[model samples]
Target: MGDETTHIEQAGPTELRDPLVRTEIKRAAVWIGMTLAVLAVIVLAQPLLLILGGLVFASILDGGTRLLGRVLPIGRGWRLAIVTLAAVAFIVGTIWLAGVQLSGQAAAFSATVTAQANSMLAWAGTHGFTPGEVQMDQIGQQLMGGLGRLTSAVSSALGAITSLFMIMIIGLFIAVEPRLYERGVAWMLPLRSRDRFYRTTSRMGYTLRRLMAGRLIGMAVEGVGTWFLLWLGGVPMAALLGLLTGILAFLPNIGAIISGVLIILVGFSAGVDAGLWAIAVYVIVQMVDGYLIVPYVARKTVDLAPALVLGAQLLFGALFGILGLALADPIIAMAKAALQQNADERSGGKAAAEP
Candidate 1:
């Protein structure tokens, strides 16, 4: 041998292992494979797995309430109960109000369609269009055909309900489980990175609370303001539509666009005047959410660019439909946080050595 010999070091600060060294490669491989396997299983069982996925965030939510209660000067449980009950009441009330509006508007729309069939056919004919009868006949057939598939999809939806219940149970368990997941994660992390994972998991509950608070507040503000605008415009079903818009708005950019499109379509169906009002309602709400509500409410929430958020929505939506669309933001935020934390650790070490 020459004057020196090489020594193996542990993996890079952020990666599973150092590619240049071989000592821990098998360990890293096993871990990586295991993680991928679990993800594959999740993807395969997504309809069922979705609920479990939700539990991850719910744990964050309920976890936050506990923290808030702790920080408050009074009994912790009392504060949490009051806040939770208020949230439940608000949701129930919004649903009830919107349901009433939906029934009224839906009934009116159905009647209008039946009574105006001949007139609509005549209008289509004058516009150099195919006869309205042919179009309606085709559409009616498609809708009826779709009913079967929709009914079949209901099974997945029922599974969804079960999933939601599962998430709730899992979340409650996680919130009280003495950070078992955290300890497990820490065990796998490199010696140097161990402390950070533990610390992050300790605060995971708080992170969830903060995220939920921002999300709920932003949504609430957007929802109320939107309903007021729709109501003022004398838009049909404004209350119900606003609630739908608000709920969908939870998903950020893509959600807003979807709700806007639906509002516009519904508006058009209501006639030119209603259509115009609906468009205005959507535009005003977007402005409010984009400029005022989102900026103010999400101030401390993850500061993701709208474009990035939308991109994630597109990618996730393609793979997982509405569920992915709903979760894209927080999932992306969590990823961003993890990356930044790793980068900071590396940079800090480099900077310390430079001086």
Candidate 2:
């Protein structure tokens, strides 16, 4: 027993001092640290969402600058200036044209939404799923409480406006000096990994640009088509519904579902005919987007799995609310590209270049 004890004593120090054991301990430490870091970031997800919004805005500006560059024989700075001015003009014009109509419809839209809610409650009561007034009140309270929490986490309206300003400023800075940020990131990595980091980032940028383009095209088409069809059908709140459709289009599959529900509810508030017409419009818009627009965009961008995107949206929405849900697909796409590159590296293969 004494001999065994002595042997273990000797082996313990030896193992501690051994280079391989030390290396493994260091590796374990690194993994643990990395895991904690990731958890910390997830906990602070709101600020991360803000940063992500900035990056998305930067990508949009950069994309516009690039397009303008191809068309005009001008310097990049000049092209970016032109593109920025045009974007501002377009936004102002849109608001000027639609603002009054949307405002006028706002109260009616709210009334319709409330009526739809009451109808849903009535149907539930008929089906023997009725809740007492107290229970309904509690549910409403809980929902408002949840939304209040989300608002606090994301900041209030003024805070949101400030965030928008910050995002635009950050985006502008990034667009103006993209290489500076890229190099700054690369500088943080080990010298040996810098080349790989740059390559991965470049691929990610290309993927992001294409993804944004596809999304913008889809939003425009969906918004315009829905508005035209709803107007022809004389659907109530057509302008508001159209606006929601456009904004929500940014969120891909999940957004479309929510917008469709809203449109149907508003349409039904008018009449059965209007409801049917709205349904037809919804189906037609989705069909065109699915069969034509999305396919063409998918060819340019990475094809995300519907299930994966939906899952990510749910998870992100739960964790980070609306902003998280909106950006979920892009986050997933970037992750997919990075993971694919890593897998290729492990297999001693090269990742395919972006189209």
Candidate 3:
């Protein structure tokens, strides 16, 4: 036993642990660290995701450009141009349509409110409640105060627009040079390790792309369905409601609830019967979305527990405002996938015990 112990000691740490083992340990540690960093990035670099999203969008545009570029195949030089043109067309079209519709709706809404206010004032006058220009001036002051809020809202909206523009610029750059980035990253890694690193990143990118595409399609369907239904029912603010429904669909369960509340509010304002009918429509639509739409569209999407998603949202919301809320689902989904992978690895790991 003493001889064996001496021999073992003499063999030293190098024999006890292979260099590859050490390398793999280092790799795994780094991999885990990178995973954590990604989570941190999601939390911290959310604004960047908008840029990333834009870049992803640009990359999609690049695909189309590449198709045409092949004959005379322009380099990615035309990428930014193509993306910018497409974006301009989309934005201009959306704005033109939205502006016309919103303006007409807003005018009608304002007129209705004005008529109501005038009727109330006249009734008060007939009731011998004579509050004259002084009351009108007080009301006007209140209106002016609300206008101040609009100024802030406009400023906020402008900031959002600027942020989106920056995102698009950043996205265009990233999309154009995605391979450059991969090559750069791989260059730093050892030859054998390079393939693994590239594979990991490629996997992530492919998965995210597929997931986002599916999610966007699902949202579009939900939006179209909701809008058509609301319009059929002659619901007030059908256009706005449809937009809201589509946007909210990305959020899952909470989105349905939010849409329902909006429908109820619109219904209530329209009158008791309209409101009841509207609520019925929203509930039915929600049921269809939950049971039918989610099962098929989100089929390959994250299959997480409802409780977990909701809990994550609450937990994230408490730490950060809306950014955390926005990230909660994606974050949770990634975590769940990681955990499942780890479990599988452990189950398949080399062991002394026989199965």
**Model number with the top TM-score:** 2
Residue by residue across 42-95, what tens digits does model 3's lDDT show?
A: 565545445544645654454445545666556657744765687668666655
Q: Per lDDT, what order, best first?
A: 2, 1, 3
Model 2: lDDT equals 0.80
Query: Which residue segments of model 3 deviate by more than 4 Å?
Result: 1-88, 95-100, 103-155, 187-193, 318-320, 334-355
Backbone collisions counted per model: 0, 0, 2
Top-lDDT candidate index: 2
Q: Report the Cα lDDT for residue 230, model 2.
A: 99
Error of 1 at 147 (Å): 18
Q: How big is the positional error of residue 349 in model 1, measured in Å on the Cα after superposition?
A: 7.4
- Candidate 2: where are CA atoms >4 Å away? 1-28, 89-101, 129-155, 346-349, 352-355
Kindly indicate the candidate among 1 and 2 with the higher TM-score: 2
TM-score of each: 0.68, 0.85, 0.60
Candidate 3 residue-wise lDDT at 32: 100
Q: How much is the lDDT of residue 92 in candidate 3?
A: 65
Q: Per-residue lDDT for 114 in model 3?
A: 48
lDDT of 1 by residue, 175-279 (tens): 444457567768888998786665444343444456666677667766777678767876666666677777876778766776776666556666888779878
Clashing pairs in 3: 55-171, 69-73
